[model samples]
Target chain A: MATFAVDKTKNTIRLTAMPKVLQGLTVITVLGLIVTLYLGYFNAGTDIQQGEIQRIFYIHMPTFFGAFTAFGATVLGGMLYLAKRDDKWDRLAVAGVEVGLALALINLITGSIWARPIWNTWWTWDPRLTSAAIMALTYAAYLMLRSGIDNLQTRRRFASVYGILAFSTVILTLVIIRIRPDTIHPVVIGASPQNAQGSFEATRGVVLALLPSLLFYSTIVPITLMWYRIRLENMLDVLEQKKIALLSEG
Target chain B: MNTPFFSVVMAIIRKDLQAELRSRELVATMLLFALLSVLAFSFALELDRLAREEVVSGVLWVTVIFASLLGLNRSMSIERENDSIDAMLLTPIPRSAIFVGKLVGNYLFTATVGIALLPLMTILYNINMLNLWVIATLLLGTLGICITGTLLAAMTVQTRAREALLPIVMLPVVLPILLAAVKATTGIINNAPVSDWQTWPQVLLIVDIIYLVLCLLMFSYVIEE
Candidate 1:
């Protein structure tokens, strides 16, 4: 009974503190999003070839990075949960996957829109595209696997195993472009940049716009979303515990 | 003189084979499914000789993959039905022994079905799929597929969705194997320059080794009651 009282107070403190933090984060993210949009639109220079369609790069590249970051978090969360058996880490893994899925969708959709203007096809089975599509599907299956299991502990264990294993796809997606020279996608960090067909040079203005967008989308937005998601999960956890406690006592 | 681990693995493999031979269920379904799928592809594609030669690799792999999915589900179902997995788990044998045993069993089932279909595919498309390179690629590729598929089937067998969920969870994870397999098969078929096709085998070998080690390491987690 004393422990239950302690639990109640702890839950209250966290519940009270969460919304203020979330409110502050919301204001900051909205401001940062606005600035990113301004930098992307009014500040970036026009591409030599792709024109305005090239501007999509400002979002597409950063979102892919963001999704990659989120997936990295998923793997970390899964590893920690497996090592420690903590529900918090499991929640973090769940949040990472959900947020990563959204970011990956943005990456794929913007990529499609961008490709139509540049590659002249809305979709191609290029290695990078194929890998990203597979990565998205892999995590989608991860989520489905979570839902299919009825036992909570078994579900968490399976999810941890999958979260760790499925990261191969993310690594494969990231490297396939750099490793394969035949890819049409530009190699931002490797030898095949010269071979890239429609890749534009990152000019001074483009670099400036790209910097903040990368920082914002890749870290700030994902962290903010994860914070809120974790808070919501904590609330659900507390309610579930309370319900179980009531049932046992009654 | 077999080490205990080897004995355990071999015993499980032998048990599975004895049961399968007695029932003849998994391989029969897989073989029939493979043949029907190949026939279906021929009817649907209706390609000329030149076109058929180009498409035979793709057609053959698609048929084999789908058929192997059927075999894998049935093989895992046997464990699920009589609490056979529980019986295996109750043993003191290492979890990896069970995994390797299932992997070898699935490999033989899927490979037998895949190899039997090759001649039929050759007859249907009038292309030679009997070459030594094509057969080698088939063996290596099916080994990779069965290793990954067996691990995933174990993970999925207890889920509420059971059989329906296996392919969804398995396919994307096994994309590297499928991609390399198809490329290697196509390379052998096209008689492309050795340089053009050399990477496929390398990729298959790496993917197979990685998946084998990873799945072995992770099997204990999935099998934990």
Candidate 2:
């Protein structure tokens, strides 16, 4: 009763049609992209101080939110994998991490680009930026650790546990920004930044641009990426199984 | 009566200490590495009078973290070398006890290396690195490292690139602890008010407890499969 089926003899999974979720997600993503580009170019008001560079917030903030959500999904997938020992959950966990890494990279680059004109430097050791860099490094280490492991079951198990453990960095990064007073990064939606420079309220034009950007980056974009990544993972698994079967048969 | 879990843990720690005492390999290398790291930092950076005072805390922590990686790698690899981990897994003792035992042993070895480096750092940096508050921070920080490092080392020991992978996996994860430790140490060295730096130890304590509990709960999975 599934939409896709794997042919064991041929070692290929055939999909009759795209799943409804993927199809719907694609439509929403296209619509969201057009709306975001329109708003970014037309509607969002330029900042009094930061000028046009502040427009990056439309994409930057949403990617930051999306990256956090991806990491959260990784934790959820990891916890479920541990409880159920399912390969699907492991696939979800890794896909979440990889997608999250890409999102985080985008968020960092945009934030850095935004910073260059405002903060007068491309990089500073601001607490939020520092923590983001560290978070990226931690997850990079997670993927590297996964590669070093050879056995399939053991790798899955260790990666799951590590996935859970590495989440501590994410928690620390999120919590530190609020609790600690050393950060110069603006707290957009929450408590005050220590030495806020260009923080602003979400004006009508800004919110119009931001809301759809959030819809795309935080939900539509990551889920679509996850869907494709999972499909690729399944195909890889099929090819690996076919190779093993062929070797044993010979 | 059979030995309790604590005694089992203590006994394992004793076995580790006795083996370390007999061979003196892990601590020796760790200490030498720590010392050499200090020399390298001093040579690489022109530690003038003000620079020496400011750089001591950062140098001390970076050295300790890397040196602890060396100790962590050896501690776990020793168990995995001769089918010993398999024998330990087969034993009647609880798996968490195995974790506690290795954790305690690693804590002691890393702590010793940290302590040994203090006097050398004091002499090289021309600032007194051997202060009470600094030692307290070092102990607290090393305790955090030992808990996480021991668990991660166990996971990495099963891999082919055991030595290379431990630091890569560990350093970033342990950055918060090192950051807090350095902050507290710097505050103390500069005679800043305790209120400014008090948050670091509290953060370190919370991080330590979180890592300890999670590593304990998760060790059974890592050791089993």
Error of 2 at B71 (Å): 0.3
lDDT of each: 0.84, 0.86
Off by over 4 Å in 2: A1-16, A190-198, B1-3
lDDT of 2 by residue, A156-245 (tens): 988988888888777777777686677878877765775876687767887888888887798888888887787778777877777888
TM-score, each model? 0.91, 0.93
lDDT of 1: 0.84
lDDT of 2 by residue, B1-225 (tens): 256788889988999999999999999999999999999999999857987778788999999999999999999999999878899888888999999999999999999999998888778887877778888888999999999899999999998788899998898789889878988898888878989898888888988998899999988888894
The lowest-lDDT stretch of 10 consecutive residues in candidate 2 chain A is A1-10
How would the docking of model 1 be graded?
Answer: medium
Q: What share of the true interface contacts does candidate 2 keep?
A: 0.71
Deviating ranges (above 4 Å) for candidate 1: A1-16, A19-28, A178-183, A188-197, A246-250
**lDDT score, residue A135, model 1?**
96
